[model samples]
Target: MRVQLILSEALSGLRRNASMVVSVVLVTFVSLTFVGAAMLMQMQIGKMRDYWVDRAQVAVFMCREGAATTTCTGGVANQEQLDAVREKLESPALAGIVRDIRFEDREQAYQNLLELEPDYADLVTADQLNETYWVNLVDPSQTDVIAEAFGGMDGVEEVRDQMQYLEPLFSALTVATYIAVGIAVLMLVAAVLLIATTIRLSAFARRRELGIMRLVGASNRFIQTPFILEGVFAALLGSLLAGGAVVAGMYFGVDRYLRERVPFVTTWVGMQDAWIVIPLLVVIGALLAALSAGFAIRRWLRA
Candidate 1:
């Protein structure tokens, strides 16, 4: 009976402040949606980084004919130079760091270039290509070690870490995530303020009932329960809406569109990720609303 009465009073308060309830709902919905999006973006960034880090290699390009580098003045890497490089790689100094190394001769390099850019078939020849050593490190971050070892070596033109090209992309994504988080925080503040205002107004409208209940010796918890419930109910509705939006976006935007359009990104935040965000959104919304409403009503009662 007590639970039913509290629920009835909460519903009545919501009806009295219909416009404020709607505002609270909309604000919570937008804030939680941004929160979910920021989380998924971070997750996508992690997936991409993990996928690329495992596969990214340090390319050691051997000197080709007519190369300009001082180390390539010998014109091209001779068999003796290649053997020396192989020996040094297998040497005790680098054995622990180098996980695997694959040597690609000019012909293999040319074939790969042709496969990637067919138009170059007629313009480029096999001899023009550099014989390369693709080195996979046990830890991708140890690229500088390989660079230091081979950068000034005879018959080596250049040593390039593939991750250097990818850092800018990751940095850009991180900035975007920060922007989303900033927007979500601002919206959440708005939602909390709206919830507080709504609860205070409801309490003011029922001041007479509250006074009578106080005279009848009703506890503060019982009196505050209905107003807190009103805020929680509105927040819950908004959270549900946000959850639905996140699910739809993952399905249509990520799964159907991005996965197909962006072939390079093999991994994406999927339905499973959305499921995780949905529950989090609900908890965040409810907790924030409860605290805001509870605080607002407590202050109003004291006043």
Candidate 2:
């Protein structure tokens, strides 16, 4: 009997202020959607970084043709110095740290470059190229070991690692995601405020009825339960709608679109990850709505 009464009152409250309820749902949906997108972006970035960092290699460019025995002069690598660097990299001192190493001759590098820019075929002859020792490590973090071994060494011109290139991209994406998440949080705060105002207004409009209920000795919980339920319901619906749209976009749209166009771009936050995130979004929405409604009722009712 008590449950039936609260449900009836909640439905009536929603019907009485349908416009306000709809407004609340819309705001909640937009805020939660932004938050969800930012989280998905962060997950993708983490997956990609882990993939690349683990599999990345440090390229040690060898002495090009007609280069001196000295090191790093005019961007050319020499033969004797190249051998010294290779021996040290392959030495037992670095055995566990270094997984595998491959040497790329001038012709191979030229062929790879051709694959890169087919139109720039005549940019350079094969003889003008320098061979490089591309080192794939078991541990990418042990880059300093290779650096310490090869730095200022003979025959090798320079060593470039993955961190030099990929760090900047990750940093930029992370900053952008943080900014997006920040905006979503501010919008969520605004939604909470709107909910509070709407609840306060509803309470004011029903003051006479609440007074009668109190005079009849009804518990405060009995009167406030419906309002709190209304908020929780609105939040749940809004979050579900937002989560549905995001899941659809990620699975049906973004994945297909990116795969069709940029197949090389990889992401780990797929359909499975979406399932995990949905519950979190729902919980966030529920908490926001319930807390906002409860605070408004408690404070305003005190007066």
Candidate 3:
């Protein structure tokens, strides 16, 4: 009976302040949507990092004819210099660090270039390309070891860790995630304040009824329950809308469009990630509403 009465009162208050309720819903929806987007962005970043890190290799580019580096001043890397580089890679000092080594000779490098940029075939030749040792490390993070070992060697032009190029992309994504978080936080504060305002107005509109209940010996908890429920109901509706937005974005934006257009990003945040985000949005929305409404009503009662 008490639960039914509380529900009835809560519904009545919502209907009385219909426009304010809509405002709360809209604010909550926008805030939670930003929250969900931030989460999915971080997840996408993690997937990219994991995928690239596992396959990252160190390219030890041997000096080609006319190489400008001081170490390659002898025109091209001779057979003895090439052999010395290979011996050092296979030496006992680097046995545990070097997982696998594949040598790409000048012709193979030229062919790969042609495959990537077919226009280059007419202008470039095999001898113009550098022979490279593609070294897969046992631990990708230990790239510095390989770089230090071969960086200034007679036959080597440069030691390039593939991850060096990828770091900038990852850093850019991280900055975007932080910006989303900042926007979400600001919107959430607006939602909380709006919820508090709505509850105080509802209490003020029904002040006479509250006084009657107080005179009838009703407890403060009983007086506060209906107002708290009103806030929670509005916030819940907003959270549901936000969840739908996240699901649709993952499906249409990521799965259908991005997956086809952005071939380089093999992995993406999918419906599974959306499912994880939905529950979190609900919990956050409902908890914030309940607290804000409860605090607002309690202050009104004291006044």
Candidate 4:
């Protein structure tokens, strides 16, 4: 009987302020969606970093004939210069840092380029490609040391760390994630304020019933439960809407659009990611609604 009465009162409150309730729902929906997107972006960055960091290699490009770089003073690297570089890399000083080393000649480099960019394969010739030593490190963090050691050497034209190319892309993604989080924070604040306003108005409209109940010796919790339930109901609805939107984005936007276009990114998001995000959004919405409604009602309920 008590649960039935509380439900009826909560339903009455929602109907009495239908417009405000809808506004709260919409605001919560948008806010939680941004939160979910920001979280998924962070997860994507983690996956990409894990996938790429392990495979990142340092490329030591030896000088080729007719190269324009100042480091190519000898015009091109001969067998003696190439042997010297190999000896230095295999030296005891770099033994612990360098895990594996592979040599790629100009012809091999041209073939590899052709495989990646077949349409423009004819534009590049073997003579234009530099022989390279590919060094894989046990720890990719020591890339700078490796680069400094090989760079400016007699036969080396340039030392390029492949990981450097990925840093800017990840940094941009991280900035975008932060921006989304900021927007979500603002929207959540708006939602909380709207919830508080709605509860205050509902309390005012029902002041007479509340006054009579207080006179009859109703407890504070008994009077406040219905209003709190009203806020919780609206928030839960909004959370569901936000969860749906996030799931759609994960499926249609990230999986269908991005995965199909960029097949090379093997570590893409999936439905399981949404499972984690949905529960968190639901909890946040419930807490925001409950706290705001409870706080707003305290002053109005006082004797």
lDDT of 1 by residue, 1-303 (tens): 999999999999999999999999999999999999999999999999999999999999999998999999989999999998888888999988999999999999999999899999999999999999999999998999999999999999999999988999999999999999999999999999999999999999999999999999999999999999999999999999999989988999998899999998888888999998999999999999999999999999999
- Write down the lDDT of every candidate, Cα atoms only: 0.96, 0.83, 0.95, 0.93
TM-score of each: 0.97, 0.93, 0.97, 0.93
| Model 3 root mean square deviation, Cα atoms | 1.2
Instruction: Single out the weakest 10-residue window by summed lDDT for candidate 3.
Output: 264-273
Q: Model 4, 77-105: lDDT tens per residue? A: 99998999899889999998999999999
Better structure of 1 and 2 per lDDT: 1
Q: How close to the true structure is residue 77 of candidate 3, measured as C-alpha lDDT?
A: 89
Candidate 1 Cα lDDT to native: 0.96
Tens-place lDDT digits, model 2, residues 221-288: 88888888888888888899989978987877677676678666665578887887888899999999
CA displacement after TM-score superposition, residue 46 of candidate 1 (Å): 0.2
Error (Å) of candidate 3 at residue 178 is 1.5
Off by over 4 Å in 2: 65-79
Cα RMSDs of all predictions?
1.1, 2.1, 1.2, 1.9
